[model samples]
Target: MDRIKFGTDGWRAVIAKDYTIDAVAKVAYATALWLTRKFKNPAAVIGYDCRFGGEMFMEAVAKILASKGIRVYIPEQFVTTPMVSLAVKKLKANCGIMISACNGPVNFNGYKLKGDHGGPMFEKDVKDIENLISEENEIDLELLNWNYMLEQGLIQYINLETIYMKEVRDNLSPEKFKASGLRIAFDAMFGSGQNLIKKLFPDEVSMHCVVNPSFHGVPPDPVRKNLNELSEWITHTRDIALGIALDGDADCVTLFDEKGNLIDANMILLLLIHYLAGYRQEEGKVVAGFSSTGKVRKICDHYAVPLIQSKIGFKEISRIMTEETVLVAGEESGGIALGDHLPERDGFWAGLMVALAIVDTGKSLKQLLKEVYSITGPFAFERVDLELNRIIRTRVIENCRNEVYQNFGSFKVIRTESLDGCKFYFSENQWLLIRPSGTEPLIRLYAEAETSDITLAIIEAARKTLVGEA
Candidate 1:
């Protein structure tokens, strides 16, 4: 058997491979042990998204926790990641477990942990749980009866979706949404981000909102490459104003403008900051992942709010959100958290907030972006995920570690930074970042420049710089 390990968020593996029932038992037992050791009567909130074997995995976790005498909170239907996070806080459970691969490809599944404060579990806690994975023991899960567990108060069903739905509706007004004269479109990408948006905006356009565990074989990541269909869905249509895509677990978000131009996370962050600070007069720190566009600093500076850069992953910024007063925090690949609400990323809320911003400013998405750029300046951003074999991936890391090349094809390296990954600066407004994925066997190359052409050129240059000699 392979030794189980966690990644940037949690344990994710291909279903029926490393993500089998026994593997889930091991992780769940470890979680049970950790909870029993940490709290006197540790209660847990558990849910799963629209993924393959979600119910099976949720049952495995519930039985394991029940056998260990821990209270388990679960839902009858599939729910989003944020729903479980919010339930953890509302139920005051010790921790939460969400069973979804969170935007990974259809063959994947994951176990995401949340703290009692409704955010990612602390790093130390995660490491402790990881260390306990090897200390697991065999258990007879079939011996546990669902009715008996329910009667014994070991497994209790909670309507986590209703919990999240009310919070989102309270913050948004359907009347105001209609008054804004802007049409909105949402693509759930066939993951758990369904139902609520339709309830909120009844007349808006929506697609892929059904429950398809396979996600139609499209990894539910909301990045631009995966969102071409959404772009085209809004374009050539009559007066559709905006397009929003949410991932499988509904924790990540991506948007498109009126013309179907992709509004990547970098632009989303800037627009959010502009709205939260300038329009709403909110105040506090803003945290962006290390791979985010540097223009975040400029916009935060314009708002006179401090910006903190965390390493890649939503958890790093979430930790700060739990302890500090963060107004906004985001990552390069569309995960965004509004600190005023919760420390976790709520893709549904993020989408509504974007709409709220549009309604508040009475402007189109492009006009709002133009206003943001007027302050932070314009920049195009792109991230390329390259699947590399062991040999080539190791070589790329070595090259980055040893400073193998000083320049790409034509872009000269002026400065370098390695907060979470190696970033090579070509000019004040242009840079390339090469970071290995903690959750997958891939390397992500990010580039930012004055235009989309330059951004693509930077990525191509970085690609050749790393693989030219391999």
Candidate 2:
């Protein structure tokens, strides 16, 4: 049997190799066992995205859970991660599972486990699940069948769209948004968020919804490079005050300003933090990932809100959120989990909150961003993905552990943090971070500075250091 390892979120492997039906069945059986042992009335909500063979994999999972006598609620069709989370919260299920990777390439599929509160499983919970997988017992999957499970009333089909729509309606005030006359463009990137915005706004907002499994041969990431068409549409129409793009499973978001310019996640984090703390008057702790910009700290300090930094991953944020009344938890990768909601990141909810911010303030996204920058100062951020051999990547990280940097260009090293990776903080609000990619065999270098030139220089210096060129 192949060793199944779960990453920051969950276990993900290329289909037909590690992600075969047998492997999926084993994981599903183990998850069912774990849930049965934990919850008094074990019930699970299962969902999948529009990935290839998603439905097939979801069916396999459903069969395994049903065979164990655990009630399973499988969505009737492909849906986003948020939909499954909403169902789990509403149905009061013990856990939820999503069978699609978020923003990965076409060939990759994954499984994400959610807690009963509709948040990603805590780190310790994930570790427990991994331990369960490690001590797995052989189980027969051939006897599992959908018909038998349905006849036994062990499996039920649910309309995730209906449940999700009701939640959106209950949370969002369309009348308020319409009164603001804010035109927004939603690009689902051919992922599970395809019809979600349209369903929520209908006649109020204009959207470009598509459900192409190929994702036009590009990964379903909401980065600027993958969203060229969205930029073009926004540029030509000039109708949308903001353009929003959601990842494959609709768990993360990327925004484009009215001028068709990509807004980096750092700015988005700062904007949301400012709005939630200053405008909403919410007083609580704020948590952010290590790779996030220092602008967040500045804003939080100005408001006297406690700021806690975690390693890169929403799971870490989720863990902290459970312990404190976290006002907002976010990562630099466009995943924002707001307070008063499920700890899991939801692009749909984040985008809607941005809309609400605009409506309530009577300003465009650009205007709101300008105000944020005025208070936080200018910050430019960029990342470089360097593909390397696995051994070389390991060596590079080990080398960075002891490596010290006195200065880079004209910036001086202020402090250093080795949280999840090596992050070098420099004077003049400049910093660089280097970490190995969990999902791929690559080293990612992230940097933020006062100017674009300085950011690029910092990234280049870090790349050279990793490659032994510096």
Candidate 3:
């Protein structure tokens, strides 16, 4: 049996190679065992996105959990990761499982486990479940007929989307947003979040909602490059206030300002913090990923709120939010959570909050960014993904470890941080972060500076250094 390993988020494998029914059975069986040991009558909520084979994988997972005498609650149709997490909390289930790989490529699928707190499972618990996976625990995947389980009261169909929509309506004021007179567009990227924004803001929102498992041959990530079409439309349109995009399973989001300028996650995180603290007069600790910009600390200091820099991953930020009084928590990947909302990352919820900020403040997204810049100062950030072979990747890591060069291009390294990646600081406000991807054979190079030109230069210089070009 192939060992299924969990990444920073979940266990993702390419379809047909390793992500087969047998492998899923092992993980599902392991999860079932863990649930049985934790609760006397374990109950779980299961869901899937609009990915290929989502139904099949979800059914397999449901059957395995039901066979173990664990009752399962599943959505009647496709749903997002947040929906499953919300279901766990609302339904009082012991755990939650989502079968869509959040933002992965078209040929990939995954399994995400959520705790009863409406967030990711604890890292320690996930490790324990991984340790429990073995051939002995694997059971007959079809031990109980799915329909028979349904008839026997083991499998219960749920309207998770309906339940989740109610929560959204309760938390966000779509009526206020509609009355604000600012038009907005949402591009679902053909992921599971399709048609949801329209349902939320029928009169105020323009939508590009569709269901395509292949993602129209593009990865369903809400990054700048993957969102050119949406950006172009927002740029050419006259009255559009901004554009929003959701990833494959709708756990993450990226935005474009009124002028169609890409507002990456760093800017969004800062905006969220400023809105909550400065506009809403909220008070609590702020949490951000290490990969996030230093502006987070600047804004937090300005607001007199505490701040903690977590390792890269929503799971880390989510865990801290549950334990602390977090006003806002976010990572560089666009998965943001607010203190007033559920602990889990909800792109839909985040978008609504952004809209509310624009409405209440009566400011454009660009103007709100300017407000944040008054504290953190003007800065630009960029990332480059270097696809290198194993040998080159190892050599690059060794070189970074040894401090091979005194500087990257002309930028001098004033300091270096090895929290989760090798962050070479050119100055207090300028730095380059080099980190190996946890799931792929690639190294990511991140740079930030006071200007976009400098940011681009730093990335180019770093790339040249890595490839021995200069």
Candidate 4:
């Protein structure tokens, strides 16, 4: 058996390879053991996204937990990661198991654990479960009948979407959003987030909202390159005011302006913070991942609100939100969690909050961005993922750890910081971050500059330098 290792979010592997039924059973058996050890009468909430083998995988999990005499609650249909997390909290389950790769490639599937607090399980707890996976705790998945377990009252079905939709409805005022005339469009990329978005705003333009386990032959990630269809649709449609996109599991978000320009997550963070302070008259600190743009500091400074920079994970930011009075916690990726809502990242919720900002302010998205620019100045951020083989990737990461890189092409490294990834600073306004993707075998190059062109140039230079050295 290939050893299962959890990454930034959870354990992911290529389906039919490492992500087989037997592999899932081992982890499920371990989770069942952990739950029994921690809780006297433990129950588990299980859900899955629109991934391949979702039903089969979820059944296998349910069977294992039920055979252990544990109560298992699973959604009647596919749901988003947020729904499963919320269900864990709402149902007061001991843990949540969401069978999703979460925006990964089609060939991959993953397991994400949610704590009872409606957010990701802490690092120590996830590690404990991973450590429990062994041959001694094997589960004979073939011997368990899923229908029999359901009949025996050990496994039950639930309607998580309705439960989750209520939470979303309570937080947002759809009437006001509809009245704003700032028409919004959504692209689900054929992942699980489609149903909720469609239910929330029925009239909004939608693309790839249907279920396609293969993700229409592309990864369901909400990155710029994979979102040209949505962008072009919004650009061509004169009435469309904004575009919101959710990734595979509906936990991450991507935004596009009226002109079909991709809005950086940093800008959205700034807008959310500014909205909370200016509109809602809220008071709390802001937590952002380390890879976030420096403009967040400017926003927090302008508002006199405290700021906390965590390592590169929504779970890291989510942990801080649970402990601190955070107004907003965001990652450089599309995940943003509002303190007023659940601690878990909800793409739909984040999208609505930003759109609400436009409604309450009576300004266009561009106008709102200009207002932010007047304070923080205009800046651009970009991330480039370079897929490399094992040999080169190992060499580059080892070199980064030893500080072997002094500069990249014409850009000198003025300073360096290693919180989650190795960050090389060229100046106050320019820097580059070199880190490997936790879910895939790719080195990520992140850059922030005075302009989009400059950000791309810096990333390109660094990419060439890193690969050349490797």
Computed on alpha carbons, the lDDT of every model, listed in order, comes to 0.87, 0.83, 0.86, 0.88
Task: Compute the lDDT of residue 148 as modeled in candidate 2.
Answer: 78
Q: For candidate 1, report its TM-score.
A: 0.97
Would you estimate the TM-scores of all the predictions? 0.97, 0.95, 0.96, 0.97
Tens-digit lDDT track for model 1 on 414-470? 988988878989998999998789899998898999998999998998877666666
What alpha-carbon RMSD in Å does predicted model 1 have with respect to the real structure? 1.5
Best by lDDT: 4
Model 1 lDDT, residue 8, Cα: 85
Model 4: CA > 4 A from native: 135-137
* Residue range 4-78, candidate 4, lDDT tens digits: 888888999989998988889899998998999999889999999999999889999999999998999998889
Model 2 bad stretches (over 4 Å): 134-137, 204-208, 404-414
Cα RMSD (angstroms) for every candidate in the order listed: 1.5, 2.1, 1.9, 1.5
Tens digit of lDDT per residue, candidate 2, span 123-215?
777777777774344577676667878988899998988998887778877667777777778888788998887776676444436667777
Clashing pairs for model 3 are none
The runs of at least 3 residues in candidate 1 whose Cα sits more than 4 Å from the true structure, single-residue gaps closed, are: 135-137, 179-181
